[model samples]
Target chain A: MSDVLAIAEHRRGELRDVSLEMVTAGRDLADQTGGDLHLAVISGDVDDYATQVNREGVDAIHTVEYGEEFNHDVYTQAIEQLYADLDPQYLLAPNSVNGMDYAPAVAEGLSLPLVTDAVDLEEDGGLTVTREQYGGKVETTIDVEEDHAAVTIRPAEWAQAEGDGDADIEAFDADIDESEIQSTVTGFEEVAGGDVDISEADFLISIGRGIDEEENITLIEALVEATDATLSSSRPIVDNGWLPANRQVGQSGKVVTPDVYIAIGISGAVQHVAGMKGADTIVAINTDPNAPIWDLADYGIEDDLFEVVPALIEEFGGDVPDV
Target chain B: MKILVTVKEVAEVEDEFEISGGDIAEQYLEYDLNEWDDYAVEEAVQISEAEDDVEVVTATIGPERAEETIRMALAKGADRAVRVWDDDIESAGKLDVETKAELLAGVVEEEDPDLVLTGVQAGDESNGATGVTLAEKIGFEWAAVVNQLDLDIEGGVANVHRELEGGVEELTEVESPAVLTIQSGINEPRYASLRGIRQAQSKPLDVKSLDDVGLSADDLESSLAQTDMYEPESEGDATVWSGDAEETAGQLAEFLRDKGVVEG
Candidate 1:
């Protein structure tokens, strides 16, 4: 079948927005290839999800159930069954922790060609996959040749799919031979303060290698507190152990799409840009006017972060919080 | 636990890249062990070094030139090394991450270590999917982008710390005999010292074909046929602004507000 198969991904009951984006990407590719569209959902409760993904122009929704929780073996087995059942020309999944887990295994298991982190797609089945090389400096594009390809899309790149078609939902029982299932999630670990993803932040004030010394972060921290912005940094800052990698914003770190992205003492590095470039508006404050950060910045302050930060704090009516 | 870490040999990131002849030139290219893969190997070594019960092993599937990659890892402290032994440049060039992952996965399935680790993503291919894929195929408990890992060999559990957006999520315990794809900065990878380099060449490595792992190249699908290679597009020079400190600050503020990114 020339139908484009799109997989829906969810966590903690919320359907990841990228799943919708995958539908958009899938639908576009389907249109380009003149193919039908099908969506697959694997979960303990596929009924609700089946209805959800159907709205995105899905002609049919295939649901497979397993444990109430996410088990890698269970999901991968479910996916393997779906691929065998549908035989769609292309399958799309988001390039995230979960997607990274399943897509490749499925690709490998079936001996299918897989191109991941695709930044763009072209008509006529030419998948222009944009991937970083050399620490995110260069993005290489490739045209894959496999007829049945599986791809994991990077988040925040594609526009979300929208439609009002709650099509037919069908329960799928791949009933994979349990012996083939390799891994099981014996448990799920929740981090200390609950799940707070930096990628989910609405406002972010990210620091970079341009900022000198650990103590200087208090200024940026002060600004963040003034505006309730999340505190984050680039790879170099984390590499130096000034901040934890969780707070890093770059290709090597979480991809952020905040309303306002403020960079202090950070010269824009490509690696860092990959994570935060999706912001609606970017603000870069560096003494170096020639910094690459300034190019993408909607607003640029070619001045010392030291002086500009405090004035913003004073004008914005706030002081640094005690950490 | 004799651990096996996989390293990739990719082109070096260049200062200035040119698009010549409609493709990237293979020569004058700089390559290193994929940074994330390096972390995976580094973490394995650190864990094994911590416990007396473990040994760190590394393997790579690339051309003869890839020997250097395995050697570099040895320099970083990997014990035994294997290169899946390739001399054909075109074959190596055509080998995709899926093929690499499948071969490594098959090999590991046979090696059967107590724990397996890989970088959550690679700097070169940047696919970030191979570890999970390999883990899935081999039937190992798989986790990705995990920032912290604590081995509980006594109970055969792995206490994993996963990084969410603004916070850290803890996976209290997962029964080991598991696969972990490490995110960058989980730990600082150790650089190989001169002493380690000399010892690496003497380490034991077994060379086998796809048959060794019960796999044939026929089992893999080459969907991502890299039709061509070329240097990436460049970011133009930045715009430099200069003036007095106070004056620049005022101009900057004005620019910010005017641009609507900041509201006065």
Candidate 2:
């Protein structure tokens, strides 16, 4: 039987949500291929993470104790060793920053075919993986000929694997060469003092490049004050030094699931949509009626945001915040 | 210091795409340099400019038309360009990630630069594996999705800040002879100046065949094939409000209140 191995990720001693999602994806692929699903967790205290990842569909949990935090070199080496020992037909990881960082190195070391950011997967004679291209505008199904493959599943694509399983926890030691690790994590620096987390906010008023000048940001702030909404922006606003990086909402920024998401002057690019698409209600204000954001928005106001925003502020309360 | 940058030309499909056979129709498609790669090229040029005796070279695997993309890199500040393509490589059709990585690895072997930089992923495929795979194939330390970078030529290390989910940034120090896949917003990519463009036309651009890289059709065989392509399903219809600013705002406020997004 073809066995599948899933790499579980943890941060700050807590299992990330994507880890369970990977288990779900692994279970489905294993069931399709008539194989067992094994999971690998590499961390300093493997026992802490093992129970969290021990789900019903999992057959075994393999632990590699390296360090508490994620070490790229250790992960690459551990996965390479684990793959050789497990000899799984498919190796799955999350299509996250951590997963994408080390999965390719493992794939290359093993000479295995790699398909990343797979949104969907099906196994017929071989594997057919679905991925989005051109910024999620089009979807393409890729067929892999290799029997053994390394794949990274996109986050939030699959439901988290639930139920309980009595999967046996095992420890595996990898031969990691200390000298080979040329990079070391210095520390994590919070981009904007970590003061504002837009992802947790209930209401958000987001700006984009269409805001034009930096001085105009005051108008959005006035609306935010009136609506009692948090202030966030697209990548351009952050990149332009108009706002702090932490206030950005997009793929590289924050994945926000607010109750009300008001997008101002933002042309919904796929990268930006991937972050805030989970919002309950979306309102878009832009001059361009054909903006992609309008498609995802529940309500669209086609007009100059400069003019429309002031009116919105007046409608909300007209209490402009000090510039 | 020597920097090698990888660039790709992607099809810019602005309108509704028609599918012929299993691929999108190319009649209405316009090709341009991948948007993300522009930031990569700009980062490489900026890094080279900060150091003395730094050489920035660009390489791409595409048809003759791809030279325009390579020229764009040179116009922005790269020293030279190399285009890797041949009849056999082209005839094989869409090569998978491994084949593309191998092809790029071949060029890296030839140049043997101190640093390799590429866009995080191509806009067309968006696989995001080529740079990391190339690093592994050529045995270089690497980092991916880097938004900030500082190179120490003497110490042979690069200090970088990588973007992560939830607005967290990871700081790492990687040794030189490394590969870095650049993320967008790393820098403001400069436009090609008229004089720079004219000079880029005269810059040294060399085209190499697969044979030159010691690769054959078999070596370039794809492990993954595109079986189908289609448009994503639309979610739902949006209510468009057409009116003056005050009227539209009032309507929007009313709708939000109805949806319980704002106070009544």
Worst 10 residues of 1 chain B by lDDT: B232-241
Q: State candidate 2's DockQ.
A: 0.59
Model 1 lDDT tens row, B170-206: 3535566787888777788887888888888887766
Interface RMSD of each: 5.8, 3.2
Q: After superposition, how far is residue A230 of candidate 2 from its true place, in Å?
A: 4.0
TM-score (all chains, Cα) for each model: 0.79, 0.91
Give every candidate's TM-score on chain A: 0.76, 0.87
Per-residue CA lDDT of candidate 2, range B1-264, in tens? 788999999887754567778777888578898877999999988887887888989989999988877888899989999899999988988877778888998899899899999998887878898899899999999998899999878898999998887677899999988999998888889999998998999999999999888798889776788888987776648887888999999998897778676784
User: DockQ of each model against the real complex?
Assistant: 0.36, 0.59
